[model samples]
Target: MTEIHPTAIVEDGAVIGENVRIGPYSIVGPDVKLADGVTLEAHVAVAGHTSIGAGSHIFPFASIGHKPQDLKFAGEVTELIIGANNQIREHVTMNPGTEGGGGVTRVGDNCLFMVGAHVGHDCQVGNHAILANNATLAGHVELADFVILGGLSAVRQWSRIGTGAIVGGMTGVEFDVIPYGSVIGDRARLAGLNLIGLKRKNLPREQIHALRAAYRALFENEEGTLRSRAEALAAEQSDQPLVKTVTDFILEKDDRRFCTPRSED
Candidate 1:
């Protein structure tokens, strides 16, 4: 039982699933696919090769699956693949991928894109990610599971936000963030491990303790280079993936540097 409003324009080739609801004045393009239980409120426009997964709810005026904003885009076939149960809020814009960015922008299940949020071309967003009001990701950013970006924050292109990491409000993230890391500042700097996030996840206390110790050994110590310290730390705490995730993230080679704490902090 699909409900499409009289003023809503669903193109002939669009795929509408059972129990889907398209509200007044909405437009669904020929290539769009709305899965079962999907709801699009009034004045929404879904275009390009986009697929709204089952149980996803999109509020008013969202521009989903639009063409990539990249200056280099030139009519290539790309897709925006959104997973199930996503909540895309008002004025949010999620663009499709470009050819150079692997031809797809993929978002995992249960992500929350708050009002005025924007997901640029070729971004990869993992499950349970949260982008607070006006948070924006530049093209090609990767956000791991449970990553939280606070209000008015912006992530630089090609930056990777690791699992359970939290970016504070008004921050500008220009580099990679380790798993469970907490970063804050106008220009983002690593503050410490996301202890609260770990606790919320109900991770064992001992594991949390190991991760904290490793964090101190890597960042607080003054003996050697950060990379060397990360290597030793990773080896020492190899048994705990929680600790190793931070170390391994530090050791990985990338164009951008990992966020580090300020000298005063």
Candidate 2:
């Protein structure tokens, strides 16, 4: 049985799954689909062609599935697909994709979108990602699994943050961040490997050691382009998955400059 407050307005075509609870004054639009165990606190608005997966809890004042903020959007039918068990905090705003892009904004499971966080249209957020308070992603940005954006961090449009990467508070990332990378500072230079994160995950010590060596070989090799070093590391550390992750990200072709340590210059 779904529990909907009398003050809430659930449109006729909206699909409400069992065990869902909608609080006072919340509005579920006609095209919205809320799966089982979803809890919408008061004053939340879920609109557009949005499908929020099971076990998701949305706090008050969240504006979800809104139209894209892009100027080219002309009322096209786009969608926002949020996976299961996400905790969307107060004042968070998530927009649907734009037709100019892929027409879909996808967020993976177990994400924590903190208060005032914003996910722009067409952004793809991976599982277990954490967006700290006011963290923002511009359109078409991709965040791999286990990535964390510290408070007030923002990623520029079309930039990709690889798996296990962390961007520190108040930083603006305009480049692609490598996997297991830690970046900080304004305009965000890569600080180093995410050693603490790897340790907490209990990756084998040997693998970690290999990753450290690979990092140095890839970044410290001042004689060649990053692509060349990445290719060399790929050949040398084929057995080390973590090392391969870093190298593969370097090999990815994108317009944004790769984030590198400050000392690289």
Candidate 3:
């Protein structure tokens, strides 16, 4: 049986699964569905056509699935879909999608969103990602699996944070971050591969070595253009998985700006 506090308002169309808990002064809006083992702490507001997966816990004062904050939002039928085992901390705000950006904001499983984190409309966050306290992602941001954003970091709209990348605290990211790299500061600088993170994930030593070499060739080598150096390195280290990751990252650039090291020329 579900346990709901007396002061909470669960709309008629809201579906609460077995073992779910709704706390005091919370509002579960119409068309919202909470799967089994979900819990909403006090003063939470879950609105719109939102669905929370099993074992997801939302802390107190969190506002989720609200209408997109974009000025162009026209009340279209958008949705916010959050996967299972996510830890949404206190005072967090996650908005639903907008018509301009495909109409859905999706958060994958086992992610941790710390206090005061904000995920704006149309964002797609992958599994095992961590958004630290006060980290903010603007509309249409894409965070790949295992990406970590430090406290107070802000990513601009339409930016893509690659898999395993780390954004340092208080950084302002306006471009696509390379996979396995680290970025820091206002105009973010590429601080090389996230070697420690890769090791913790059990990636082999050879792969790490290849990645370190590739990173040096692309960013540190003064021999040629980044693309040319990457191509040359790939010719010699084609078998390395890290080489492939680096090649794919360089080739995947479209309109998104990437931070490059400051050249004296």
On lDDT, the leading prediction is: 2
lDDT of each: 0.92, 0.93, 0.89
- Clashing pairs in model 3, backbone N/Cα/C closer than 3 A: none
Give per-residue CA lDDT, model 1, range 1-265, as digits (tens).
8999999999999999999999999999999999999999999999999998999999999999989999999999999999999999999999999999988999999999999999999999999999999999999999999999999999999999999999999999988888999999989999998889899999999999998898888778888777878889877788998888888777777344788885421
lDDT of 3 by residue, 70-160 (tens): 9999899999999999999999999999999999999999999999999999999999999999999999999999999999999999988
Model 2: residues >4 Å from true position, as ranges?
A: 254-256, 263-265
- Among the numbered candidates, top TM-score falls to 2
lDDT of 3: 0.89
Q: After superposition, how far is residue 245 of candidate 1 from its true place, in Å?
A: 1.5
| Segments of candidate 1 deviating more than 4 angstroms | 263-265
- lDDT at 250 for candidate 1? 76
On lDDT, who's better, 1 or 3?
1
What TM-score would candidate 1 get against the native? 0.97
Reference-based lDDT, residue 249, model 1: 75
Give every collision pair in model 2.
none
The TM-score of predicted model 3 comes to 0.94
